[model samples]
Target: MVRLQNPVLKKELKLRFRSFKSFSAIIFYLLTLLVFTVGFFLVVTDFKGKGFIGPEMNVVLFTMLTFVQLSLVLFMTPGLTAGAISTEREKQTLNILLTTSQTSWQIIFGKLTSSISYLLLLLLAGMPISSVVFLFGGISPSDFVLTYAYMIVILIALASIGILMSTLIRKTIVAMITTYGIMLFLTVMTAFFVFVTLSVQTGFDGSELGGQKPFSYFFMAINPLIHMASVIYPEVSESALTVTSMDLPLWVTHISFYVIITVLCLWIATKNIRVNMK
Candidate 1:
């Protein structure tokens, strides 16, 4: 096995830990989860008793919480990764790093991985809260596994997008804005396309017009949020709110494609760095 040297990973992790950005993000997410869980418990308890919430309600709450968490990840991931490389260039540190024995790919991965580690830690911190939801009775162990796995895939995809933007842009501000713009485009535009497609197909019929079909299937396969929502609540497939449906098999295919794309982006970034160095 090839051991990766990542001095920057340790340094960046320490820096991120000490910074308010990481601290605030983790604290904010924890507090939000706590408030939601407490409010949910209170509503259920007030309505009847512990049994009132039931297993289905618990599952619903867990699924909702997972959705909210994924949204947070989507919004914050670009912030973490968009400046990783461009910021180094801005600070005139790229030459120093290039002079070292560390390969460009290693540098890129180290920065990307280190940034993601902080977010993953925050997600893991919420695991106990998620488990507590299980205590109330709706979610299964399989649900937890699927939810976490989806989160991991989402993080990788977002980080790759950010890193690609970082490598392409020289200024940190431009990179940040561009990264976020792309994220918004991906999440919002794809959803809009799905909606428009469905509308044109069924004329707002009650039946789901998208999913495992031609155009709809292609977009649905790529949208992480859509894939996860479908997996958690299959009933959403029949709802007007559901723009697309995605099964576990579709999720796996999407994740595989995203991973391959990320690898390609990393390779390109490495090549860019090497060419610039030369």
Candidate 2:
């Protein structure tokens, strides 16, 4: 059984809260979410028109909030975790950690959980406002769960990427940038690549209009955003062939890719930390 008594996690959690920058970041994040949600609400209710929101708008509102929150998660989680190990190395404290009773894997997992704990705070704090969609009554509990569950999976995958980069790179800033660059490749470049490829094959206007090739499905499978869109609209598979020729849903492939990434990245990180031990 995995142990929950990680001293490193406890220590980092304490220090994170004690830091002024951490508090300020939390405050700023919450304020931005609050204001954005309020403005959305005002616009939805039609400040000059309907003065009230209807149930029909629930899906639209939830879609907007979900995508916005997902974007924030993608942006913030990498920053928080990309410095996890590299920051310690910068302070010459990683040697201290290496000498501790904790295994390198323990250290890796501990730092990861501590960093994700802060991200959890941001996600949970935003929930009440996002829940306004639930009150209006179009989004089912199952839909909500699927969307967020995939999000958590994506965060774990991204966090693992950050941890691996943090382990490999000596400079925290460089590691952070590299981690985000990888994220950009996964999220944006992959999508663009598929689009350009499709355009070339089918023509820009799709005048020839050949069916989607299997190669396109591969890109869509790797992209978190595309899968998240599938989750939002079940009908998407009907349109995009679930971004794959396979019978399984696109999310199944999306999650499978992320799971492999998380495990592979963590394994590489643990191995690196062990190899560098002096």
Candidate 3:
């Protein structure tokens, strides 16, 4: 429990909230979402000649906002956490920090959670703007809940990756770039790989290793966007989606993978910190 009560977390939170930049960023972030939502709504409604855009409109808006939020989180998370440790080391504060009462795990957890907390705050701030989806009549409370929960899982994975990169790299810039590189590889490259594989399989014999959609879908599960898309897509059956060989929602596999990666990254970061402390 004491490890959870990390001084680093408290300090980071205090400094973050006290800064005008954080407030401004949150405001700007929400405003940006608002503008996009309104712009999309205007275009759809106006072009349709004042007719109801139907339930599909709500799905479209929800999906667009989900992707937008995912992009923001993916891009912003590294910058927030990638400097968490390297910056301290760069400032020659690592030894000082190491000598404190906090253990390496505590320090790592603190920095990780503090960074994520800020990101979570930004996401929650935009919640009201996203809630406009409710007015359109396609999305439900469960959808919002699951989507936001999935987002938190994504944030944790990204933040952990950033923290691990920060701990391993001595330079903040390198750490930041490396973090983004890994994030991009996961977010973009995986999708491309999956798309290519599916396309090739479809073009060849209309069969993927013997007519299995789940096999290709496994690659889709590797990408968070795909999981989110499946969850957000109006046509996808939520209650009936089981993994190829398991009795669980396909998104469950993605969640488990993310959780495992998050834990591994954090564990490695703690180990790195311990090594540095010596």
Winning model by TM-score: 2
User: How well is each residue in 1-278 modelled by candidate 2, as lDDT tens digits?
Assistant: 35657888889999987899888887877787777777777787666645666667778888888888889899998899999999999999998989888988889998999888888887888788777787778799898888888888989999999999999999999999999999999999989977875666675665545555666777877888888888888787666673334465567778788899999999999999855436
Q: lDDT per model, in order?
A: 0.78, 0.84, 0.83
Query: Candidate 2 or 3, higher TM-score?
Result: 2
TM-score of 1: 0.86
Tell me the lDDT of model 1 at 36: 85
Q: How far is candidate 2 from the true structure (C-alpha RMSD, Å)?
A: 2.5
lDDT of 1 by residue, 65-152 (tens): 8887888888889988999999999999888988888887788888998988988998998888778876777566887888888788
Candidate 3's residue-wise lDDT over 1-278, tens digit each? Answer: 76457788889889988999889988888888988987897798775546576777788898999889888888889999999999999999998999999988889988988888899999999998999888879888999999889889999999999999999999999999999999888888888977776676564566434344564566667687778887887344342243233245667678888999999999999988755433
Error of 2 at 93 (Å): 1.0
lDDT of 3: 0.83
**Candidate 3 Cα outliers beyond 4 Å, as residue runs:** 1-4, 47-51, 199-215, 234-248, 276-278
Evaluation by lDDT, superior candidate among 1 and 3: 3
User: Which pairs clash inside model 3?
Assistant: none
* Model 1 accuracy (lDDT, Cα): 0.78
Ranking by TM-score: 2, 3, 1
